[model samples]
Target: MASTILVTGGTGTLGSHVVPLLREAGREVRVLSRHGRASADGVEYLTADLLGGEGLDPALAGVETVLHLAGGPKGDDLATRNLVRAAARAGVKHLLYISVVGADTMPIGWFRAKLGAERAVAESGIPWTTLRAAQFHDLVLDTVGKMARLPAVPCPGGLRFQPVDAREVAARLAELTLGEPSGLVPDLVGPTVYGVAELARGYLEARGKRRPLLPVRMPGKVGRAYRAADNLSVTGALKGHRTWEDFLAERVGQ
Candidate 1:
């Protein structure tokens, strides 16, 4: 029997990619979600709520490893605590967490929450690996898509991003799940850094639409953080093969 691996956010954008990779690597995969989704031929989907702490024991039973890809804009710390507690009780050997690049230093609530989650994993007393990645290409597309739908597209002139492919992140997470726990590694980023305005223009070009580009400065400290490149990786820049242009060309361009 293959070793069972539990994934908290198995249906999410990154989780969607990670699950298949785990299966391909000969690990039996279990997904914990609110909805009791049907299981595939080699997959098991279980019901669980992180906030309520229901159904975790059974979902985590006999699982050797956990790839925690489940997170949201809110309640990151609480969710992580619930999972950490459950995993500790269940005797899970290795735990891998997914966090965004610059989560610790960024002046954003979501980042703060993520940093807290990272701390939880570190202090869990269980062996773990936490990988920080640059913004996913899909997320960037979602942001630019909303802006590109109007007469004039407004973009953050100084806000920079290294939009990485989710598959790459998933691949790295899978590697971590199968290996010994490494505390914190260098950030995985895209091949190039792009300002938001440049990305907005790329989005327009991908859709074959020419729109007026309004470069605007972001307001507030969070905006200042972005302007100062707090969102970018400083030293450990593990470059991903895919770029914003590649994603746009394949996904958006007709």
Candidate 2:
């Protein structure tokens, strides 16, 4: 039997892409979902709750590697703790965690929770590889879409983000799953960074909508951290080729 790789949040945005890649690589893919009825070719679905620890034992059976992508919107610290304990109990050989960049340096509540989760994974005694990647392009699109829903789009002044392609990130995670569990590899970031306002404009243009973008100067340490140059990638760790322009162009053509 081929090694089964369990992907938490396998139906989600990033996981959807990762699942296919793993299947293509000839690895048996098992998805842990709440619904547990969804199906994909070369993959199996199992019902499991990360928070409640339900159905994990059966889902984890015969699983050698786990790509843990399930987490709350604002970083539920409790969920990570529970997941770490569950992975350890399952005797999983390698646990791969996807985290955001600057999670340790940022003072935001979400970052704090992520940091706690990272700590838990590190101490879980299970072989683990934690990857800190920049913001996703889909997240950029979501931000713009939310703004378009509002009366006006508010762009944070001096805020910049190095947004990466979800497909690229998923590829890296798949590669890591096939290798030895090295703790906390180098950070992954996009080829370039762009201001939030400019990105919003690009998004608006791509979607064939021109909305008034209101740039606002946000206060606090979190805002400062976003504006800081250190928060972005200055050297190559894992460099992505996709750009916001490419993402927007594809959107425009669609």
Candidate 3:
């Protein structure tokens, strides 16, 4: 029998891309969803909620590896705790978690939650691998557009980012799920690091709109940490093939 891999948040942006690749690799993929949606071809969809702890046991039964991707937007610690306990009960062999780059160094609440989740996975007694990746290109573009809509793009002064392609990240994640569990692999980053203002300019250019990028000083420890270059990875850990310009041109059209 093929090894079963349970993918949490299987209908999400990254999961949509990942599910197809896992199926193509001939693995039995099971998606944990809340709505109990119909399973995709060569994949199974099971209803499970991380917070409610509902339908987790049967969904995890016979699953050797778990690609844990579900978590609260702001606080992942509680959800991660529940997942760890459930995985322990199910006798899961390996757990692969996807985290953000600079999660440990950044002072943002979201990053803190991610760090807490990483701690849980490390101490869960299940062999685990955690991949910390830079912000996705789509996420960067979306944020820029949203800020621009406010009539001003707020770029934290001197903040740098190495935004990566979500597709590539998903591919790497699928590869990790099939490999041996290693603790905290090297951070994955994009081809280059660009200033937030430049990123915003590129976004506006793609949309054929001109907008002033207002560099503002955010007032808080988290804002200060975000303004620092420590949020980005300088050393290329996981090299992405696509560039930001390429992504924008292909997706948004030049």
Candidate 4:
């Protein structure tokens, strides 16, 4: 089991943490990335681009369990489908995937793509488990931080976010990888939920910046979905304990 575990997106936010934990547990970890960088000692780095369907079969040669985390701005479904096909060809045992909480019902391009990817996973014929998680705290804060530079920062109204920590998600993924494949595990969310405006203010406070908050009410289906708080999983697994404030204090306060 240890020698056959392969983690895609090994250089990303969640994968960075997941790979080390796997290695530390004495699992022989192999990473497949476009950049192909060595993250840990004795870990193998395989080159592949899922969307292009290049170099995947070789990567899956000896890999049994694949923790799929690689994604991009678009073509998420294509990438996942490619990987799924390759996994099936390689006779992979279990496929673990990372997805967003609202991917199933949300009316957005990214969400739709993610949902499509989920379908591909389900139909792949590989024993699979997918964990839908709330937004990551770092991603939320990064967005807010980028907008905080403007004189007036725009905030979406009635939008609630339960931002989980990437490391916390990584830990859960590790646990899932170690265990048997349970199809579509419960969502992993943050300890608390906060409005977008509240998160924006928190970001401003953490960065020691003062900007006028311009509340925006979005005018489309996507905006309506956000307004309805579709992103918050009230009855989810809620595995993450780190709050946005905790993330801010540790990452931004430093």
Worst 10 residues of 4 by lDDT: 34-43
Structural similarity to truth (TM-score) of each candidate: 0.97, 0.93, 0.95, 0.97
Clashing pairs in 3: none
Candidate 2 local lDDT, 115-175, one digit each (tens):
8888888888899999999989988888877887777789888788888999999999889
- Work out how many backbone clashes candidate 1 has: 0
Per-residue lDDT tens digits for candidate 3, residues 12-82, read 87888888888888898999977677776878999877877878889999989999877667658777778
- Per-residue C-alpha lDDT of model 1 across residues 100-145, encoded as one tens digit per residue: 9999889889999999999999999899999999999999999999
* Model 4 lDDT per residue over 198-225, tens place: 9989988988889999988888888888
- Residue 14, candidate 2: Cα error in Å is 0.8
lDDT of each: 0.89, 0.83, 0.87, 0.89
Judged by lDDT against the true structure, how good is candidate 2?
A: 0.83
Question: Ranking by lDDT, best first?
Answer: 1, 4, 3, 2
Looking at model 4, the pairs that clash are none
Model 1, residue 43: C-alpha shift (Å): 0.5
**Cα RMSD for predicted model 4:** 1.2
Evaluated at residue 213, the lDDT of candidate 3 is: 73
